[model samples]
Target: METPERGLLARLDGFFFVLAGLAAVYLAYLTLREGITPGWPMLLVVVFWVLVSYLVLPRVHRILSRVYVPDYFIGRTRTADGLLGDPVNLALMGSPTQVHHALRAAGWTRADDLSLASGWRIVTSTLTRRSYPQAPVSPLFLFRRRQDFAYQQEVDGSPSQRHHVRFWACPDGWFLPGGLRVDWLAAGTYDRSVGLSLFTLQITHKIGADVDIERDHVVATVTAADGTATVRVLPDFFTGYHSRNGGGDLIETDGHLPIIDLSRVDVAGAPEAALPVVRIGRPVQTVVGSLMTSVRGIVYAALSSLALIGSRDADEVTAATSVLLALVLGLGALGDLVLAAATFAGHNWSRLLLCASSVLGVASVVAERLVGNLGGPLHEGLLPLATSVLVLLALSSDSAREYALGRRRRRPAPADQPS
Candidate 1:
């Protein structure tokens, strides 16, 4: 049976496929009308579209999930079971020890132990907390009061079975103050050490928290054996919020810690610990990028209009220019809309849209060039220049700058610190 999450993901995948098809059809129409050979350009566009659709979108979705989807694992586990259950569940949650034991029991000498991390490792906590207010305010609210809350009673005299789990590769192998908890296990149990390890690697290395961008500081706490650890994050850590009630706090940290080589220890798991990925700050970047890209398209349309103003057959030039303008503006608008949808859509579709747009842009440029209507030297030169300038501007924007700088600084320091 398909779980709700699986259904939602399926719908999202279908939606993007439809969107890509529409964008491609529109681009094809313009290409054919302009009497251009849609060979290399079309192929490149389709390839790019597929890459964005399959690869970039999935990665972006993962990043977003890590940011916004708190309790991501809980949801993901459900979906994985719904899609390819037996194998995926085993691969995702199965312990190396369990696999090794099973293989050994089956008389296999090659069975090896896989050391994996599991359980919740708080990547970076934002001021935002999931709330279940009694009243229904916005449909946009994810954890509505109508769902995600429940009550249960123990009927048997037997005590509830408690599951042991451990969080590996935590920044300092320490828990936040009053953050750890334990509870009875109603679901099946497997060592989550691997999941914890993968989660830590993703947050600390592969996927970055948006705090590296929006906030001017990076705060990370590492716990030592003594349970006394210091954080070496930026000076501006936790500066975004003051109190959950009101106001804000200015948090800071320097990227240096006293804790080292904190090993894993067994502990009980909590209900909240099973929650899937929670993403924060990713949507802001997507929305901002989409808006800026759309604005550039509008500017491009204006330029095209001005260029066609004084021709012998002004009507024809104007019509053709309008068609081109519509293509650019329409695609830009669609891209922005898709990006906006992504904010609530629980998936990343912007990459696919971007790829499609890029493909179409290239095709349009080539088509315009082939038909004598690309204007003289100025028009020919301007298009490429405009595209290059836009790309550069997009790269240099505030969000992109922060992301780049954050990534650079996240790397290990040189052998010697400069005096």
Candidate 2:
């Protein structure tokens, strides 16, 4: 019997393979339309297939999760007792003076310490505690325009924390996880951590009361019987996204404080669990997907190359067709490559590239349509030209050289170097 976490993980894996199969079928459609050549090399097809499986699959996962999943899962919150729940809890229940003293002792400088009005305390506590509500669970239909999943964490007969994760499933079997927002309440001075974990994800605030505004990730402050030590827990996504965007963060008291862990639980004997594996038996599926993508790319490249050779004489139709084909192929290929880079680099640049490519493609298409070239190839080809330009920009050795040299110039001069 698989644990809930393990079961969910397996389900996700199966979902990915199913997605890959769909991609293969789509690719087959494209290949069949163009017809496969007898001379098509098997090795080339195999290599392309591997790239689609390894590279394209991951990208698709990220895009789907972001575009489809709900905002609730993307936003997470976890709270626990700080300083081992001894001094902090004591101070919280103690007089205002005592709490102030405790805060001072914990190296917290209260620049604006004021007692919250009546009923404020309840609201604040409610925000920090993790509690779940009793409600009938429903299938999170990915096919629907709006899908929602709600889970609550409860303690002492009161709701302590609540989570509402939502997502939208596209026709491509991609779940765009969005609307992941969390709310909690911690009674007294409790240790707490909350943030999102995704591919090239970012945290913009501190997790503790004595927040350090300069930091980008969560760092826990530990207070023991002897002394206090600040610790940091790295963030990672748990589910609803690809591994690049899949990581989890630990947020609980370091000592013997009660902690609640709330996440997706895959119930045993679920019908989805019994679904047969689809990708393993269909090797030809991936092959077809790979070939289709490759043929599309080659055709686009060939057309673009032709345009470059005879760009002057080519009628607007030919130019547009070549450009449009190239743009589609280039954007698809580059999108995959950029996502792969983002997975490894975990930087902001990957997102920028992806966004730029998407925007450029849309803009070109809109421009062509609005400019009265609806049937003309030029309108269609503009995106391909832009894609080619972007690809060249990305692959250019000169750009890389300039970037390296620029970084070197920005580095501080060594003390040994004549100051």
Candidate 3:
């Protein structure tokens, strides 16, 4: 299959991605040193695990994967951490709505989109052995984003044991490796138990070794539910192989590929899982941007307070000028804090304000550089300047903008609703 070529903007995004990875490495090293210096052995070990698993190793994997992993349609899914995830062993030909309809008819429960609430719900429900029929699946990426949707079937009323599959809508004009046209691709796996990920040491579900069983199970259920739907197989679509998934569980699959034709399935109701995935929750850029804004505001507030305190007994002219400057700084700091909170709450206006403010800050630095007046930390383009630019880029990103827009569109004044 032909690989998609990334545009200039996409290349620019990769620069930022690599930069972030490097910065995370430095952060982890610094924290590890500090923790060790304190001589709290257990704390140091725990802190090291937290930093390494969540930050260091993922960044390392990302950098390495970009260099080695094939970017084309490889009939496999990738984890967020850039590890090769479950193999894609199934295909479908139908509109997303029809696909969802068939799956639901087959008695599959639509998995909840992964979010803070659903994530926590699954964790607690698993601990209590309570059935969470619609528990969210951890995200696995395809087509450069997470799965379009997922469905699951709980076994024996156990939250920990289930049959689940993640599906991705095929990109337009995209074809399978052998020139076969398909509308969607999927990875089906059975979660046997909860265990730690071997690659990253994170607690996650462990899958059964033989994934062919789950693939057959999905086919059986879908076709059994809808008489109109039919499936055909592609023999030896991939070389049959045994491998380990990202979570370190063994996975073996036959080379067969099943294409479920859902185009003929009847549909009469609003499709549930096929809706645009806008409600997957806030993007990471927005989260990071809000955090940086809040930190900047707090720093400004602290400095302004200190300045006012120190100027209390200064000479008359100095005291008056200092107090006025402090008050102005204090007001600006308060605005920053408010904007940060509103941005986190998914307010587009607040995001714009933050982005605009960062633009001005960047512009001022450029202006000073042009006049040869830049010096000190800003002169060296140090952390403060870098932070401003990052905040600007993140708040102005497409993901952040789309998320803010989606949130606003979903929420409307109560009076505007049908009474």
Which is superior by lDDT, 2 or 3?
A: 3
lDDT of 3 by residue, 1-419 (tens): 32253354345445555555555554455445445544443365576677678766766687788788887777778887778999998899898889988888899998998888999999999999999999888888888888988999999888799999999888879888868899999999999999888888888999999999999999999999999999999999999999998888899988799999999887877554454654557888899999999998898899889879978889989988888888988987899899999999998779877776776665555566568764332223434555666676576655777788788668866986673
Displacement of the residue 113 alpha carbon in candidate 2, Å = 31
TM per candidate comes to 0.24, 0.20, 0.72
User: How many pairs in model 1 have backbone atoms within 3 A of each other, for residues 3 or more apart or on separate chains, i.e. clashes?
Assistant: 47
Q: Which regions of candidate 2 are displaced past 4 Å?
A: 1-335, 340-345, 373-419
Give the Cα RMSD of candidate 1.
21.9
Q: What lDDT would each prediction earn against the true structure?
A: 0.30, 0.31, 0.80
Instruction: State how far residue 166 of model 3 sits from its true place (Å).
Output: 1.4
Which prediction has the highest TM-score against the true structure?
A: 3
**Candidate 1 Cα outliers beyond 4 Å, as residue runs:** 1-285, 288-296, 308-419
Model 3 ranges with Cα > 4 A deviation? 1-16, 37-45, 268-282, 313-419
Clashing pairs in 3: none
